[model samples]
Target: MPYLNAAAVKAQDSPGIISVGVLLLFILIALQILNVLRKILMWWIRLLWWVTVGAVLVLFASIIYQRGPEKTVEDALRGARHLSEVWWREYRRWEGYQNLQQQHHVGTSQKSWTSRW
Candidate 1:
């Protein structure tokens, strides 16, 4: 019963519309400050912008964590990892084939020149 109550509380408190509005408001203010700071500080502003971008990305990720379906996120990450590994293996194989082709071309060219002489 306690666990059920806790789950109910969590479900009820989840961000609906107001929290999203507040998040957007903070983001807008942060962007405006970043623009002004960049104009005043130049390179420092660029560094700040990168930091801001990192923070924003993290915030967006957290928002997704809070809002999105847990199972879907898990499945997506698993699929993404699988795809990346498959792609890397394929890329390495391609590179190996390319190197072999290059070697074959060089060896053939050398043999042809030797035969001509």
Candidate 2:
């Protein structure tokens, strides 16, 4: 019955309460460390994402360069000039053919009219 007094009860319970407080403090420290680790992990994930994006961009650019119409501005200009020249040559040839056909048709028509008369 003496141990049941208020002072004895308080003294007896103090050790358990102090131990619980210490345990809670350790848990708080552990949670803080976990939070820091989570932040670091997120940062690394973000960095990796950017690196992957950069790599994809490089790959896309290389593919486009490889498969594009012309490699450089100079090449494009040269291609355009060649195309224009070919077009002009074809146009002149077509015009010459048309002119020769007109001349042949006129000559035959005149001979036919003379022979008919």
Q: What C-alpha lDDT values do all the predictions have?
A: 0.84, 0.84
Q: What would the TM-score be for candidate 2 when compared with the true structure?
A: 0.48
- Judged by lDDT against the true structure, how good is candidate 2? 0.84
lDDT of 2 at 107: 79
The alpha-carbon lDDT assigned to residue 48 of candidate 2 equals 100
Highest TM-score against the true fold, candidate:
2
Q: 26 in model 1: Cα distance from truth in Å?
A: 64
Clashing pairs in 2: none
Q: Residue-wise lDDT of candidate 2 within 1-117, one digit each (tens)? A: 775687567857688876787899999999999999999999999999999999999976886688684555566678899999999999999999999887997877555455676
**Deviation from native of the Cα of residue 48 in model 2, angstroms:** 0.6
